[model samples]
Each structure stands twice: as structure tokens, then as C-alpha cells.
Target: MTYISRAAKILSSRVSADVVILGPTVIGEGTIVEPMVVIGHPVRAKLMKALGSDLGIDEYMDSISSGSQIGSNCIIRSGTVIYEDVVLGDNVETGHNVLIREGTRIGSGTRVGSGVIIDGETIIGSNVSIQSMVYIPRGTVIEDGVFLGPNVVITNDKYPPSRRLDGVRIRRGAVIGANSTLIAGIEIGENAVVAAGSVVTKDVPPNKVVMGVPARPVYDVDVFIRKRAEYEGSKAP
Candidate 1:
């Protein structure tokens, strides 16, 4: 059961909506956004009204863009700015002050916490958990079962603030901890674990444990050999 407050009802007349509204937001049609939520459009910049009344063409345009794709049974909380051409699957939850940029595709059952800036053209797979203050750079791919801890920053530029080209790919089951940095063009193998506060400059092996600046292998040769042998033995007679 969805409930719309009296305030939301009055605000809905000045705005667009589907079922419920708990706070201020310039929403689109067919969207059932939840309470205390602020969806679409970024509170109109100071320089915007100085130029024109065409809020549609203003810097905060996504606050009122059409053709947005929000699936059923999703909970979009307060102060979330979902940009134009963004597509979200069912059962997705977005917390406060999160900026989901245009051309992004989010799979089902993904829970994104507050203050996350998911850049354009990023593909996030199902069952992913992204904590707060994480910046998923443009054109990146986050596959299934991936977990990103708070303050995790993923970059796509070896040159930073810009890349020679566009796009970076993060494979499946890759768990990046808080304050870790991933360099450009490096493929983090499936099920890899990156330690907190580490800086990665090279490719990480599958199911491996890596840490520290220019993150290297933490396990000894004997440990690697023993683990590999045990794995191999389990598969054999």
C-alpha cells in the first residue's frame, strides 16, 4: 500500500507523478516514487534563471526530462537526481543525494547508498551493493555480485580528470574496498579482493588477495602453492 501525504498531493499538482509523493520533486509520468523523496532536476542552479525561464533547457534539466525509465517497485529516496535516458530495472533502491547520470543501466536488486555519483553509460549488474561516496566513472561495467565499500573510488583514466578514450570494464564478483584506486585498462579478475586504502596499478589475478600501494600479492609462494594444490586435490581423487 502506497500513501501520499497531504503536502505531496498539493505538490503533485504543481509537478508530475504516478502514485505517491512525500516531498518536492519534478517527476515524470508513470513513475511511482516514494516519500520524502526529491527526484529529478537539481534544484536549478543560480546562473540558470539569469539566462532563461526554459527550465527544460536549464542546467538542471533532468529535473524535468521526459522518457525516463524507472521500473516498478523501486524506492527512490530524498534528493536523488536521476538524469535523462537513464534506465533502472525492478527492485532498485537509491538513497539520498545520489546522482545517477544519463545513459546508465542498472540491473535488478541493486541497492545504491547515499552520495554516489554513477557516471554516464555505466552498466551495473544484479545484486550489487554500492556504499556511500563512491564514484563510478563513465562507461564502466560492474558485473553481478560485486560489492563496493564506502568511499571506494573507481577511475578510468591513466591520465586522470580525463581519459584518452572512453570506457572501462569491471568484471564479475569484484569487491573493491573503501579508498582503493584502480588504474585504467586493468582487468580485475573475477572474484578478486582489493584491500582498503590500496592503490592498484596492475591487473589482479582471479580469487587473489592483493593490497598496498601499487598493490602486489600478499601471500607467499608456499601459501599460493599450497592453496592451489588443495584446490586441485579437491577436484581430483
Candidate 2:
């Protein structure tokens, strides 16, 4: 059993009874929030509005204040913290201790592993698999069926703390290997495979295999996939 705060907006009759919602967050029917999940933690809208008023840009505050929404049948695991204005589609699942920040939109059937931090304003497509300890910065776009291995770092800023930031875009069916680092503004094309421990600095073409520091295209991704399949088959019992 879970405790749902009276301030929470529960549109669903099937939510876990003990979850804590601190804002005007909406949870769709059939969504399951495990014990200790926190949704819509205070965004200080009023204070933000005041600051914006002082700065002569109060309209910015309005875009920042809408509460979060979880779609039907989504399973939010324990110890996950979702900030305000984040929208999640149906059947999305998150592992323990995941932190999803504000203004992000996650499509259906995405599985986010434990210890993942998805920063604000990210757009993630359906059926994406993001493994543990991956850091996705703000403004990133990940298309459908993308696979991100553990400890992948997707950067969004070319210069540290710069006013301008451009996020990396991963196209459909791209596979980013473990411990890979994608610098800001790089595009991983459809079906591209980034080898483990690679640092990608530029755009990777479709169906290509890239490896090493300042990653360079090594071969066709199909060749790598076939070799991988054969190796796995040989190891099978």
C-alpha cells in the first residue's frame, strides 16, 4: 500500500495507494507507482514567476509550471524522482533510483535502467532501452528502438556552462555501446553502431560501425551484427 498525497491529481483508479505526489500531477489509469516514488516535487512556480516578473519575462514562468503526467500501465519503480511538467506515455518502465527532470516527453514502451538521469527537455521515442548509469542531458532527441548501453554519456554543451547548447540526436535503431561518449550536436544515424569505449565527436552515417577515440567508421553495421550473431550462436548450449 502507498500513500497518495491529497494535493495529487489521480485520474486513475488503479494507481498504487501509497505513492507520494507533491504537485498537481496526473496519473492515468492502470499506472503503477511503486513504493517511495516521488512525482512533481515542488518547482517553485510562484517564486519563478516573481523572478521572471522582475526580469520582465513573466511568460517564461507559465511554460514552466504545468504538472507532470504518467500514461496508462506505466510502472514507475521505487526511489524514482520525476520533476514537474514531464509527460510519460503508456507502458513506460523505470528502474530504481531514476531521476527524470522537467519538461521531458517519453514515448511508450521505453525502459530506463537504474541510476539513470534524464535531464529536462529530452524527447525519447517508443521502445527505447537505456541501460544503467546513463546520463542524458537536456534537449536530446532519441528516436524509436534506440539501444543505449550502460554508462553512456550524451552531452549537450560544446563549451562548459555556455548559454547556447545543442543536444545529440540519435536516429531510429541506433545502438550506442557501453561507456561511449557522444559530444554535443552529433547525430547517430539510423542503424549505426557505436563500439564500446568510443568517443564520438561527429555525425555517424546510417548502418555504419564506429570505434575508438574521436570515433571513425570502421565497417558496415550489418557485418558487425552478423559476426556478433555467429559468436553468440557458437557460445549457445
Kindly give the stretch of ten consecutive residues in candidate 2 with the minimal lDDT sum: 56-65
Summarize candidate 2's per-residue lDDT along 111-179 as a digit string, tens digits.
999999998889999999999999999989999999999999999989888999999999999999999
**Model 1, poorest ten-residue lDDT window?**
7-16
The backbone clash count of each candidate, in order, is 2, 3
Pairs that collide, model 1? 40-63, 41-63
Candidate closest to the true structure, highest TM-score = 2
Q: What are the runs in model 2 whose C-alpha is more than 4 Å off?
A: 1-7, 11-14, 44-65
Checking candidate 2 for backbone clashes, the offending pairs are 2-17, 2-18, 3-18
lDDT of each: 0.68, 0.86
